[model samples]
Target: MDPGFIGDGRTVAVAERSSLTFGVEEEFLLLDASSGVNLPVGDDVLARLTGQASEQSRHEFRQSMIEMVTPVCGDLQQMREHLAASRKAAGDAAAAIGAQLVAVGATPVAEAAVSRPAAERYERIIRQFGPVALDPALCGMHVHVGVPDRELAVQVCNHLRPWLPVVQALTVNSPFHAGADTGYASWRSIQMERWPSLGPSPYFASAAEYDDAVQQLITAGVMLDEGMVLWYARPSARYPTVEVRVADVLPTVDDAVVVAGLVRALVATVTDDIRAGLPAPRLRTSLLSAAHWRAARDGIEGQLVNPLTGVLSPAWELVDDLMSLVGPALTRDGDLQAVTAGIDRLRVEGSGAERQRRIHRAGGDLHDVLVYLAGATTGSVAR
Candidate 1:
């Protein structure tokens, strides 16, 4: 399929084969179905997905969790339906072995005191990454939205820096770690940054500049490679997509779809704006981190740093405003209803993080979280 974003010239191009190809990867903690604790279940699940869905379930560093990669979905609705089917396949496969699937950027219950997952690759990763591996409090859902050209991918990544926090605020689900509450919405964001490349990337004038920056980070031990630079926004070397690595794991498949819609709309909107000669906002790197910290620390309870100006703003208010910012792009790209409707649905009921906290407050145990995971994972998309 022709890439959706503009070519190397930075002009927005009509997506040829697919309007916009997206790949959604959800990182899940595998728990002992009977015990409600994390363990290495990735290898077995990956093996199962091979014959079943096949080629989509690849290995992640963690043993206890599986990363489900959906096929390139051209639009938001297709992305939702494809992801829903993929999750179903993974859930049924995991259930056969007394394990269950979960979605969260960080699994608050197991992150602080991670019990080993059964996979050998995870054991290898643990041995390779010592203290960095111990927190066990992180899980993340990554969405890759396709861009047409290598240069365009780099440009979109550069433009994407300021908006990263918006998704972080929207998807903050992890609020507890260890046996006690961590007092943060998505503590996993901080924990994942420990891996070297965990935040926004600097401006890349061209693809070569992007590559050089990636190389320097690796040489400086800031990153192992382009892959290790797990920035909130980065151009994928393998696919013609820029992956957004913010959003905490959703409690349910429906929540994941909501996030996916916003991500696609953001990319389309920004890409279109750039093509129209509207410059992408430029904020200092430090400001980006502050916004992230606020979102991680407060969830929806406190105001977050506005990405455009670095001013503190209420999370709810920010959501309403951001929806307006992306309104035209969402409509032009045909994701308007999905994106707006998704956010509206999320606001009315509550977020996955709120539900997680509520469950903990009522029961004060992992049992309720586990039950929430199971019920959410197995059920159909909520209306």
Candidate 2:
């Protein structure tokens, strides 16, 4: 059976014309506070969370990671507050067990051991994937922006394809892996490429086309379910939002807020274009995949493929193009100033991957990189 298909009689609810609500889900690595080694204690950390924190947090595929999700937020400020509180809550819980909740895309230190929680789904994944599941776990950030319905969500994803590489460049936080420099800005993204059903989503003309693609993957044993699509962006099956999963987990709350605000504005801009009867650009998935790889390799430090022109340009120039594209929507959402300031900071300080490399170059080791991540995650370090 095709799980992605929605019956024709189902009514779809459209979002209001007001500001679109959005949220973020961040996955963090649990590391030994002193030794910087990965710790497989996700269940213990969850047990320490109380009340709302307990409700919002959960374990990931491996015991060395935990994920925190913020409630739906109406504006960027509200999103910022919720993200900060959620990070603090989760960080505190991890600290209670002598573990540090580090906002890193990949574990810097080698895993002493790998353990999967006793969940049937996770067990099945490990059984099916074998060594791939046992590889050093990677962390990522997913931004959910409210959309009207599945059909519109699919169209929005087409519009979103051109910008995914830019978004990935903005949040490249994983540079070191297994206590050594990997030379790529987002090693987590590289690790994820090992999956069979991962990379840029194909451009779909309607909801039915999207469903058909997912069904084909399932039938071919490329994916176990619709939730396993693993595309850079997709119409989330469980939510009424298009989930953008291109970014690595950022190193700081401020960084997360910046990405979230930009993403929301991008969605708003694209939704308006769709309403105005603008046709989505038909860029090939192969070209998008190449652009994505360049973003993962260079981050913001070098050149990037401008998806609009299919040419190589300085990364910041492409970033400027993105800002110009989403400028009006940012203004409408009252996020222009904050988003501008955040981009400026990223320009001055560099992406999280660059910052990690800087710390390592300053007579520090990978353990020092972990310390910086821990402090940055809790807002205790200066950007």
What C-alpha root-mean-square deviation, in Å, does candidate 1 show against the real structure? 3.8
Per-model TM-score, in order, reads 0.88, 0.95
TM-score of 2: 0.95
lDDT of each: 0.72, 0.88
Backbone N/Cα/C clashes per model: 12, 0
lDDT of 2 by residue, 131-169 (tens): 988899899999988774779999999999999999999
**What lDDT does candidate 1 reach at residue 248?**
80
Q: What does candidate 1 score on TM? A: 0.88
lDDT of 1 by residue, 1-383 (tens): 12333243322233432245676887777776656667676778777774526556766666777777776666667777777777788888888887888775665455323455457655655676678866674578888887757788788887777777877888887776654577777878767777756676677788998888889877786655466667788887666678888888787767788788778777877777777877767777788888888888877667889868868988888887778877776787687877777788777766677777788889877677767866686564342
Give the runs in model 1 whose Cα sits over 4 Å from its true position: 1-18, 50-52, 111-129, 380-383
